[model samples]
Target chain A: MHILIIGAAGMVGRKLTAKLLTTGHLGGTPIQRMDLVDVIPPHEPQSEIDIHCEAADLSTPHTAPALIARRPDVIFHLAAIVSGEAEADFDKGYRINLDGTRALFEAIRHTQSYCPRVVFASSIAVVGAPLPYPIPDDFHCTPLTSYGTQKAICELLLADYTRRGILDGVGLRLPTICIRPGAPNKAASGFFSGILREPLVGKDAVLPVPDTIRHWHASPRSAVGFMLHAASMDTAAIGPRRNLSMPGVSATVAEQIEALRRIAGDTAVKLIRRVPDPAITAMCEGWAPGFEASRARALGFRAESDFTQIIKAHIEDELEGVQ
Target chain B: MHILIIGAAGMVGRKLTAKLLTTGHLGGTPIQRMDLVDVIPPHEPQSEIDIHCEAADLSTPHTAPALIARRPDVIFHLAAIVSGEAEADFDKGYRINLDGTRALFEAIRHTQSYCPRVVFASSIAVVGAPLPYPIPDDFHCTPLTSYGTQKAICELLLADYTRRGILDGVGLRLPTICIRPGAPNKAASGFFSGILREPLVGKDAVLPVPDTIRHWHASPRSAVGFMLHAASMDTAAIGPRRNLSMPGVSATVAEQIEALRRIAGDTAVKLIRRVPDPAITAMCEGWAPGFEASRARALGFRAESDFTQIIKAHIEDELEGVQ
Candidate 1:
């Protein structure tokens, strides 16, 4: 089986690509070829065989058909301009987030003779804050931010195109991948884990929103699992509504502290310092807490059972950098 | 106050334009100027000032800004390629329904610093077949047709823009205008009234759907009323979610036959010919049976009370056009 992973250099992208390579392929077809595409070509794999790692901005109209020429049986798209960056920069956001994503879909529509599973990485940001409790699978999407709006609009387009038989598409709107393994990036939510992980390792970190503020989260491992499952799931079951909220833990800032104390003893809690940034606080307020991921759950997607496991996964993966 | 009515040559457009001209302006401002825009220019009306009837294709990008330069205080956007035409011509549908509408909105967005009350002529087609009875105000839009999808997307953009204070917009998703006050066009649902209408005035017409099928409807008078009321509604009270379902009646084909029988006696019923079209049946199956237009009713947007009223309205309005 030939596989393509757009945005393959990103954190989750690396994990999913390695996992796919390890498992090799579906139904006994080994993934003989792998196409890794990003704005910057990722570090070359240490494999003897060929692996196509090309650096090109996929937002360009020509990029999609070029990628489609690879004829990937499974296309894992994890590329996007993150929320904070998107909100701050209108042109860059719309360019990469909206036009780029749309161009790919359009390319697929015109190029593909046989529909392939287009596994899209959506985010819970698609559903905005101050939401109805236990937000149902089919809640009306009222995104509060540009990133969320872009995701929601793309979801609509995906559903419509799938209905038109353009491509078999599924949008997995992932919860924020807590304990993201990397150096602290510019993402506003980076502080959620930074405050915890940094303190656990005796490093100071900023706390943006209050500990009492709530959010939905899944670990990086689970996000990769979601991609794998979405690739194999029966799309006919999902029908025209191609998007689903990926399962995740709904935890408040207080819950994170409590979990830290439970998993790493009181030392982790003491490492956390209280400081508030008004901008981050206001932005966080517009986000939703829990989504009743009924549709995704029924379709056999899984997540960490508890926040303690989230901490444990961090300890295992980033601590050792292991699968 | 000034008013502009696009598609002023169409049935609803002409009625609404005439009504507006006779009624004068909203908010106690006399409509000192009127602009009628269509591909086919409207008939010149004798006004002390001037009646500006312009020939233009709104689907092109340049035309919108050029039109908006008139800056009519109340703009009634009734220009559309209709359902059957839109469905058959994909490019034209996207060009007019999606691109044209977006261009118009963008034109409004960029033209100086005036916020005009844009009364958009949306349709019940935005909501496909509802599984649950009484489709609520916040039901997820799962449009089954391209025209519906385009309209639904425009509604979203309009709400977002209004929330951003870029435009004061109101969208009215009108129920199928029953006994549309002229010889039937090629719309699949045309025969619903045509069988009775064409025959009542001594002409043969087709019957395309089953008697069991039920759908929401309103008369041309009500459709015009919807436009006028939408144009004048307290948009500040409407808030961010500006698109609304106008009040309408739910009636089956059998009820329509009964309406014809009651209003036009046996002659109207006898004029009805039974020749079913599967294509219409398929299309109609994807239409909403009824709507919970509680919001519109509460806000004072009125439509025909029942099928009998619909038939009577048609007889009253269409008598002169009849042979």
Candidate 2:
């Protein structure tokens, strides 16, 4: 199988790449070659199969078509500007998130007879405020943020393009990656992971919101799983609604800390400092707390059931069980 | 106040223009100038206010920017390829509907200081089948047709642009327009109007679907009312959900014929011939039967309460009370 990964330098993309390499197969077929593209040059993974990596900005005219010209059998589109950056820079957000995605889809359509399996990285941000707890699968996407709006529009395009037989596409609306394996970033969602990931490593991490603030989450491991499953699953089952809200664990900040405490002891929990920021707090209020992702679950996608599993997965994957 | 009407040659656009001329004011301000554009040149309405009409395709590059250069206070954007045409011609549909709308919004954004009230003509086609009767406002748009997909995408853009403060946009998801005046065209929706219109005027009209098939509808007069109301209504009242499912009458084909019988006699009803075309039947199956347009209703937008009123309004508006 010839595979292509866009935004392959990103965290989940890298994880997915590692997983694919370890398996050496996709959808029961042996890997023959792989292609990767991102704004920053992706590291060329050590694999027996022919592999190529290139740096490309998809929003630029002709970039997407050039990437698609290789015509890989499977394409994983994981490129996007993060929510914080997207919200701060409107032009850049729409350009990369919306225009770039549309350009890729258009390029795929231009190939005429070639219809590859396309897996898109959508986000939970697509669902906005005044949401019912455990948001149903059919809930309308009324995103409160620019990033969410861009992702929602792409989801629409994905479904439309798939319906038109232009390409076989599946969009996975990934929940916030819990216990994210990196230094805390400026993303508002960073706190969700920082409080847990930082504490385990004996680093003090600021809690930006109250312990009562609940949000949906999945580990980076689960995110990779969601993408691989989406890449291979029977899309005929999904029909015209090509997007699915991937299953995830719903937890409050308190629950997340408790999960960390259970795994890493009270000393770790002590490292979490409470210093509320009203801007982040207000923004979190409009985010989805939970979801009834019955459709995705029924379609055979799985995730960590609780925060403890998410934290444990992070330790095994990121910390190499050092803690 | 300066006014711009895109697709001014369309049925609803022309009616809106006529209505505006008669009223001579909008949003409690005296009319100043009116600028109209369409693929076909709009008729320069006889009015005391300055009026200019031009033939232009909004999808073309530089067209929208040139139109926005005048900086109209209110813009009524009603341009689009209808359902059947859009379905048959995918590239044209995206070009005219999606790209055109985006270009116009981009033009407005480029103006920097100007934020006009933009009333967009969306459609109930945004919603697809396996739907709930009296479709709720919160229902997720999963359009089954290309036209619906285009309109839904534009609605997302409208909301996003409005939120960014580039324009004050109100998108009305108009139900299928009943009793459309003038010649019967090849539009899939043409039969809905033809069955009522041609028969009332003592001409035989083919019924493409069974009488049991129900659909949502509003009069052309009501559609015009919706545009005017959307233009003048308080945008602040709508919050972030910029689009609304407009109020309309929901009736089965049998119910529609009965209303016609009541208004124009049994002779008018007899003129309807049952010629069930499978293509139309399949198309109508995916359409919404009704809508719980409580949002628009609460906003003081009104429509005919029943099919009888719809028929009467058509007669008074189109037939000049002769019927």
Candidate 3:
């Protein structure tokens, strides 16, 4: 099976590539070749699988068909401008996130007669704040941020493209991937994990919001799981609209801290420091608290049960390198 | 005050133009100048108001800003490929519905010191199939048709553009306008009014679906009311996202028959012939049975209370020329 991973330089893309290579199969289909593309080509993964890396910028008019020439069977499109970047720079955001993504879809559509199964990496940012209760699978998307707006726009394009039979696609709206590896990043959600991940290694981390502030999350392992399952599924069941809200664990900052304490003792808990930033707090206020991904579960997609398991998954999967 | 009307040759456009000219002011703003453009030139409205009519197909490139040059205080953009034609032609649907709309938006954004209240005539097709019982104001949009997808996509663009301060816009998802003035039309919903209108004039009409079919509806008067109100309202109350699901009456097809029974007696009923089409039945099955337009109502926008009011509206408003 030939599998393609767009945005292979990003965190999830690199990890997914490494994970797919070792597994050899996704949902039982054996992986023989892996195609990777990004503005910056991905590094080599030490594995038995054949890997082809290409440097391409999708926002450019001509890059689509060039990437589509590989003729991969399954494609995981994880390329996107991060939320902060997209929100701060409107032109760059829509150009890369929206147009670039559309170009990729158009490229895949014109590639040969056979359509590949596309696993699009959508985000919870697609569903922003001022929500009603726990957002169900059927809630209206009222995005407040530029990033959210861009993502929501892409979701519509994906749905319409799939409806037109241009591609067999499934978009996974991933929750904030908690306990993100390597260090506290610049993401708005960085603090949430920072308060947990940094403290585990006895490093001081800031808390931008009150402990009561809640949000939904999934582990990186679950993200890979979502891509794998989306690749394997029969899209006929999804009908014309192909995107799915991936399952997530809802918790506040305190709940996240409690999970850290439970798993790794007081050493992990001591690293958390309270330093509130009103800017971040105000920004997060409009975001939806949680999601009820009943449809995804019904379709056999899964996620960690709660924060503790999410932390457990991270430790077992990510912290092994540290040890 | 300057007013621009896109798609000025369409049925609603003609009616709106005639109505505007007869009443020279919208909410007391004198219609000093009226600029209109469509694939064909608009009919000359019989009034003292200055009417500048232009014939230009919006699908062609670089024509959007040419309309914007007039720089009207209010712009009523009612242009789009109709449902039947849009479904029949794929490329044409995306071209006009999506790209053309985007171009118009971009055109307005590039205007020098240009800011106008954009009154967008969206449709109930934006929300299709598998609705909640008496669908709430915030119900999700799962459009089953390409026409619905296009309108929904434009709504997002409107919201995003509004957020970026490019334009002050209001997208009214008008319920299927009943008593649509004109001869037999191609729209599926046209049959609803056709069966009633043609029969009232002693002509036979086909009722394709069973009398059990229920749909959301508003009169042409209500639709006109929505645009006028949208043009004048304090869009700040609407915040960044300016589109609203305009209030509408939900009634069964049998109720339509009963309303006919109440007014014009059995003569109106005798003109109707029942025929079943499985295609329409399957199509209607997924349609939203009803909608709860709380936001629009909360903002003082009102649609007809019932089908009786809808029929009465048609008689009072449309019958102006007949007598």
Candidate 4:
């Protein structure tokens, strides 16, 4: 099977790439050729399969058509401008996130007699504050930021394109990846991972919000799993609603701290420094606390059920099981 | 107040224009100037207020900027490719419905220190079948048609632009306008109006769906009322959720027939011909049956309570009480 992975240099994209390479196949079909694309050329992973890494801006005219000319059987669209940057620069956000995605869909449609399975990486940012305790799968999208709006719009486009029989598509509303395998960042939701990742690695991480603050989360491993499931699963069962809220562990700051303590002792727990940032706290208020994700669950997409399991998955995947 | 109506030549637009001209003011502000724009030049209404009629395609590059250059205080965006045409022609649908709307919003944003109250005419087609009996204010948008998709996407843009302080926007998800004045068209939803309208004029109308089929509806006057309310009301109460489902009368075809019988007697009701087209019947099953519209009702947007009142509205407004 041939495949194309956009935004292959991003964290989730990289992880998904590594997993795909390790398996050497997807859904019982052997991987023959793959193209990895992003704004910056993705790293060329060593593999027996034919792998092409190229840098391309999707919003640029003709870029999408050139990429689509090869007619990859499955296209994994993981590209996006992050929430913070998208909100800061409105024009850039709409250009790369909204127009870029639309251009890609248009390219696919223009290619006569060619319909690929498109797996889109949507986000929980699509819905904002005034949310219910556990957001249902069918909750309306009222995103508070430009980034979320772009994603929500893209989801509508994906479903419409799918309904027209131009392309088979599925949009995964991925939860905020917890214990993210990266350095500290200024992203408001970064603290959700930072508070745990830093303490586990013998580094101090700032806690911007109170321990009572709850949020939805899943390990990066589960996110990759969701991507694989989306690409290979029978889309007929999904019907017209192409977008779905993915399942994840719903935990408060206190619960996350407790999970860290259980894994690495009080020493790791003490590494967390409480320095309240009112700005970040206010932002978190509008963030999704949790989701019902009943549809995703019923469709066989699984995730870590609790905080401890999430921590274990992170340790096993990123820490080489040494932690 | 200076006002611009983008689709001033269309049915709802004509009605809204007539209402505005009759009042000679909006929100206590005396009529100053008005711009009526459409693909075809709108008929210039004989009014004391300054009025300009122009034939312009919004999808054209400079059309939106030229309109926004005037910087009307209240912009009623009622332009769209009807559902049937949008479904039949893909490129034209996206061009006129999606890109045109975006260009208008972009033009508004680029204009320095100018934020108009944008009253966008959205539709209940944003939601599809497998719907709740009374779809609530927060039901997810899963549009089944390209026109619906365009409206849904525009709704997202309206909310995002509003949140960013670029424009003060309100989107009204208008129900199907019943007793729509004019000759019966071939639109699947046209029958909803046709069954009542043609009979009221002593003409026979075809019913393509069973009497058991129910749908949501509002009169053209109420639709105009919703637009006025959306433009003049204090948007502070709306907060971040800029789009709303307007309240409307919900009735089964049987109920509609019964109402017709009450108003025009059994003879008029007998003018309805039952010739079920399987194609339309299948489409009707996926249409919205009703909506709670609690938020719109609470905000004082009103509509006909029952089919009888709806027919009465048609008589009073269109037939001059002669029917």
Worst 10 residues of 3 chain A by lDDT: A314-323
Per-residue lDDT of A269-306 in model 1, one digit per residue for the tens?
Answer: 77776788898898777777888999899889999978
lDDT of 2 by residue, B108-141 (tens): 9999699999999999999888899989888998
lDDT of 4 by residue, A239-286 (tens): 899999999988999999999999999999999999999999998888
Backbone clash pairs in model 2 (N, Cα, C under 3 Å; residues 3+ apart or in different chains), count: 0
Q: Comparing 1 and 3 by DockQ, which wins?
A: 3
List native contact recovery per candidate, as a fraction of 1. 0.19, 0.67, 0.67, 1.00
- Candidate 3 interface RMSD, angstroms, 1 decimal: 1.6
Residues A62-86, model 2: lDDT tens digits = 9989888988899999999998889
Q: Candidates 1 and 2: which is better by DockQ?
A: 2
lDDT of 4 by residue, B1-323 (tens): 89999999999999999999999999989879999999989999999999999999999999999999998999999999999999999999999999999999999999999999999999999998789989999899999999999999999999999998989999999999998988999788899999999999999999999999989999998999999999899999998999999999989999999999999998899999999999999999999999999999998899999999999998999999889
- Cα RMSDs, all models: 3.1, 1.1, 1.7, 0.9
Ranking by lDDT: 4, 2, 3, 1
| Model 1 chain A poorest ten-residue lDDT run | A42-51
By TM-score, how accurate is candidate 2? 0.98
Which pairs clash (backbone N, Cα, C closer than 3 Å) in model 1? A129-A286, A129-A287, A129-A288, A211-A253, A211-A254
Assess candidate 4 and give its TM-score to the true structure: 0.99
Ranking by DockQ: 4, 2, 3, 1
What candidate 2 gets wrong by more than 4 Å, as runs, is none
Would you give me the overall lDDT of model 1?
0.79
TM-score of every prediction relative to native: 0.90, 0.98, 0.97, 0.99
